[model samples]
Target: MEINILAFGIAKDIFGASKVTIQLSDAATIAELKASLEERYPKLKQLASYMVAVNNEYAESNLVITERDEVAIIPPVSGG
Candidate 1:
């Protein structure tokens, strides 16, 4: 399955684009997607932390992801 991901903040820089598409096995979990991303973009592993949102809501590691789902990467944010 091909998953389209929207990147924000540092995540966009790490991916070198605001949006990216990746291929994954059917019914892959958020954890799997994270691993795949870190593998493709090593800089992702250097982040303090990041979150995955599915369909506008934060998603858990075990949450199953489908091709039709709306996915986004929310990088760590620091504000004064």
Candidate 2:
């Protein structure tokens, strides 16, 4: 299955792109996708507070990600 992932704000810096395409197996969950990304990009591993959105709506990490799903990653914000 092909999942379209978007990296927003600082996430793009860590991921080195605004958007990416990831090939995943069926029944893949957000957690699984996250793990795969972290394995590929060690810099992203420390970003545990990121928010996920599936097809433009907020989604949980445990939620299933389908081939038809468009995933977006919104990393945690920091401000003073």
Candidate 3:
């Protein structure tokens, strides 16, 4: 399955784009996707913290990601 991942904040800098395309197995989980991304983009593993959001909601490691799912990379943030 082909999943389009949206990048934000520092994630955009790491990916060098606002979005990226990743190919995964049909029943791939968020954990699997994170591993795949870390392998492809080592920078991702360096982030202080990050989370994967599926369909606009924070997803757990076991959350399944489908081809139609809206996945996004959300990095840590700080505000006054």
Candidate 4:
């Protein structure tokens, strides 16, 4: 299956684009997606932490990703 991810902040810089496309096995979980992203973008692993949101909701590790789902890569945010 193919998924389109929306990146923000450092995530966009690491990916070199605001959006990235990735291939994954059918019924892949969020954890698997993270692993795939880490494999392709090593810099992501260096981040303090990140989260995957599906359909506007924070996804769990076990959350299954479907092609129809809207996926976003949310990097950490800091504010004074």
Candidate 5:
């Protein structure tokens, strides 16, 4: 299955881009995706603090993600 992954803030920096399309097994969960990404991009391992979103809202780690799902990595926020 294929999924569209969106990167935000530092997440983009870590990925060196704003978004990417990844191939994942059917019924893959958010946690599984994180693990796969970490293995592919070691830098992401350290950014584990990031939150995840499916479509337009936050998603749980256990939430199953599919090829048609829109995933986004939400990095920590900072404000003055």
Candidate 6:
């Protein structure tokens, strides 16, 4: 399955684009997606932390991702 991910903040820089496309198994989980992303973009692993949002809601590691789902990479945010 091909997943389209929207990047935000530092995540955009890590991916070098606001949006990216990646290939995964038909039944890939959020954990699998994170692993694949870190593998492809080593810089992502350097972040303190990040979150994955599916269909406008924060998703858990075990959540299954579908090709039709809306996914986003939310990098850590620090505000004064």
Candidate 1 overall lDDT versus native: 0.96
Model 2 pairs in collision: none
User: After superposition, which runs of candidate 2 have C-alpha atoms over 4 Å from their true positions?
Assistant: 78-80
lDDT per residue for candidate 1 within 31-56, as digits (tens), equals 99999999999999899999999999
User: What local lDDT does model 3 show for residue 2?
Assistant: 93
Itemize residue pairs with steric clashes in candidate 6: none
Residue 11 local lDDT, model 4 = 99
Give the best candidate by TM-score: 4
> lDDT value for candidate 2?
0.84
For each candidate, the alpha-carbon lDDT, in order, equals 0.96, 0.84, 0.94, 0.96, 0.84, 0.95
Expressed as tens digits, the lDDT of each residue in 38-69 for candidate 3 is 99999998999899999999999999888888
**Candidate 4 segments exceeding 4 Å error:** none
- Residue pairs with colliding backbones in model 5 are none
Q: Which ten residues in a row have the lowest lDDT in candidate 5?
A: 39-48
Count clashing pairs, candidate 2: 0
Root-mean-square deviation of every model: 1.2, 2.1, 0.9, 1.0, 1.5, 1.1
Clashing pairs in 3: none
Score residue 17 of candidate 1 by CA lDDT. 97
What lDDT does candidate 4 reach at residue 80? 75
- Model 3 regions lying over 4 Å from their true place: none
Clashes of each: 0, 0, 0, 0, 0, 0
Minimum summed lDDT over a 10-residue window in model 3 is located at: 71-80
- Tell me the spans in candidate 5 whose CA falls farther than 4 Å from its real position: none
Residue range 2-79, candidate 4, lDDT tens digits: 999999999999999999999999999999999999999999999999999999999999999999999999999785
Using lDDT as the measure, what is the rank order of every candidate, best first?
4, 1, 6, 3, 5, 2
Candidate 4 vs candidate 5: the TM-score winner is 4
